[model samples]
Target: MELEVTLLGTGVGIPHSGRAQAGLVVRAEEPLLFDCGAGALLRLAEAGLSPLEIDVVLLTHLHLDHVSDLLALAKARWLMGANEISVFGPDGTEAWFEALRSLYPYLEELDVSITIVRPGDEFSLSGLMIRAGEAVHSLPALGYRIESEAMAAVYSGDTEPAASMRKLARGADLLIHECSFPEPFVVTNHSTPLWLGGTFRGAGVKRIVLTHLYPQTVGREEEMVRDVRAGLADETKVEVGRDLQRIGV
Candidate 1:
């Protein structure tokens, strides 16, 4: 099967007309969801997919923008007569779910399995090998590298450029990175083109899809791509990712 990726929501925590929130679907033998933030379920539908079809969810962190749709997805699946789903995330994932369950109480009834992972852990799911690496963010975060037999993709969750992320993305066919702002904005725990491009160049990534765009960054796509091009090798392809855009890996 071809490794395919669909950008479900390319927007950041902030709302935008063209973009939703942080979400994507990776299709290998099975469809896996990464970072199901606000409006993710609706975007999944827009992508011509059903929430019940996604059994595995990989979260980079517990940021609300990256996980606001967790409960919504669970409820949707439950209503559809599917209950079993697995979640994998960085440390504190289980505890965070527990806290949510405590407040909602009904979450306890959802048949979901939560796994807490640490940096450097490797695991297999849906015939794909996935590895996690530390990410520099406001909270404990992880960047994921997923590989099939001949294809690979890396997701740089909400993070600043870091060595671990660079190592994880090295040689990947596609690097889906979060570019929350344009150059010289200097936001904490997020990336601008200047920092992201250097990391992408250092990793020698072949193709980059910039997601997690903030409103201010939407109209500056050309400038961001130009800045990244200035830092990266000419062979490296860079493009702005939009919701529902699909690419083959």
Candidate 2:
């Protein structure tokens, strides 16, 4: 089996040149989507992938920066002659989708499937097993660990260096963790490289790709990388993710 992961959007809520929002596409046993933030559709098109190719859309949370393009994907797939699409997310996901669909009464008749997932929920589809874990964010958010026959990748969506995230990413081939702030941001519900560095110690993760970078992290990229490298004893590869960058697992 082969696995490819694409970083569609690596920015946070705000937009920037050469960066979009928080979205990722994982192509393995199943074509799974991580988040559908702003500009996700455009990034998908840039990657030469159509919305119809997506089999599942997995959301991390209900934050607008992470799920802004949900409706756009649904509409695109509907127009492209695809059948019902599956969307899995944390609690309140069903209500959120229902509210969005209400805005487009025309789509009410379309075939779309929305499944609400909670922490510790395990499910399988298209020869892949997905497990949802709790995230250290404001609302009821979740991080996912997807395992196929050959490899696995874990995605941490807008978390603050929680133990659950480390547990979920244990021994994974790739860990797509968030590095929203630099150091000394004094913020909650988001992570800084300093904090993440401490949590990543002895985690045994193969590689770390930092995403969801905020504007504050613009000039501090090198410092973040150095700090993360200093903390990990294992020779873990660290890279700052960019929009449309493709990674193989």
Candidate 3:
């Protein structure tokens, strides 16, 4: 089967000119979406993909920047005559969706389906196996490792340096991790090049793509990439993820 991954939005909370928020699409046996931020649906449309083509949507956390477009996508699919879309996320997902439905009375009566996920759980859909692992973030968050016959990818949803993430991404073909800050910003609940680069070096992942860049990352991309390369050795491909960029594994 042909496997492809697309970076829909690489920006953090604040959107940039060529970047949106946090979103990615992994297309294999079935299309799986990760993190539906503000402009994700539009980005998907730009990629020529319809909401109906997405079978599953995996959320990293309950943060507004990560899941702002959840209801919009759900409602779009329902209006387009598509079947219920499965959603996997942290502990509070069920409650979040319920609260969202309450606001949109039309959605309450829709035939959409929701499945709240927990960490350390494994499941299969569309001939692919997915495993959810723990992520160190403000709220309960998860990182995912998706595997199939020919390729595999690990997505680190907004997290600080966590050993669990390294274990989850070990030997994966691609690791999509967040680089929220440049370095030495002294922020909590976010990753910086200093922290994230060190973790990636120890993790020894193949091909690291940095996303979820904050505005602070501006004018410091080269330095961040340099630090990551210096830590992980030259062979590790460190690239800044751009909106609408596609990669095949």
Candidate 4:
């Protein structure tokens, strides 16, 4: 069976027309939420899912745009009397989450288990296997490679150009990458089309859906797509991702 993937929130910290923050859902026997950003919880509801149904949350990093909704999810579940939730993320996740809990002592009643994962680590959830790789971001971050019975998908959390991600995503059926900017741009810790085109080399990616867009990409979506597509296989499917879009892998 194909794993259902939903792009709940596909924008950056900045506001955009219909875009929210960074988030996605990969559904297995149990739904798994990735990066509970500012608007992801609401977008999740819009996508015909409830925060209550999500028992696992996987974080790529601790950036605000990636984790602003962490407490909100906890509170929502607690309010609805849902079961406890588990969170998996890179190292320092435990300490960071503890700080959030300390600020909201009233949420202490809700039980949340956080597991710290590092680059090169692998873990299994439901019927899928997930492997973590390094990401080139300002703060420490990770990209994920997820595999099910027949298909594989990779998510580039928030990175510039990462060879580790390329290796992890080798032969992936789907790639949800963060295209933060367009071409002719000099940037660090975030990807431009030119940078990403070169970065995905040798990954043998089959399908790509770009996300984590910033306001600068407003009128240049096609150009961005064209740039990235030029570097991929002729049969590779590439498109700019939108909020609440669903795909199968």
Best by TM-score: 4
Give candidate 4's error at residue 160 in angstroms: 1.4
Per-candidate TM-scores read: 0.96, 0.96, 0.95, 0.97
TM-score of 4: 0.97
Candidate 2 — which pairs collide? none
Flag clash pairs in model 4: none
The TM-score between candidate 2 and the true structure equals 0.96
After superposing candidate 1 on the true structure, give the runs of residues whose Cα lies further than 4 Å from its correct spot: none
List, residue by residue over 29-111, the lDDT tens digit for candidate 2.
Answer: 55788899989988999988888888689999999999999889888888887758888988899998998899888897667
Off by over 4 Å in 2: none
The alpha-carbon lDDT assigned to residue 178 of candidate 3 equals 88
Query: What would you estimate as the lDDT of candidate 1?
Result: 0.88
Candidate 4, residues 109-185: lDDT per residue as tens digits? 88889998889999899889999999999888999988987999999999987888889888999999999988877
- For model 2, what is the error of residue 244's alpha carbon versus the real structure, in angstroms, after optimal superposition? 0.9
Task: Give me the displacement of residue 207 in model 4, in angstroms.
Answer: 0.6
Model 3 residue 235 lDDT? 79
Candidate ranking (lDDT, best to worst): 4, 1, 2, 3
lDDT of each: 0.88, 0.87, 0.85, 0.89
Candidate 3 lDDT over 1-249, as tens digits, reads 556899999987886778888899998777899999989989999998999998688999988888998888988988888748788888878888888889877676666556777878999877888898899988899999988877778999998877888889888889999888886677777777767777777565778899999888888898988877776754788888889999887
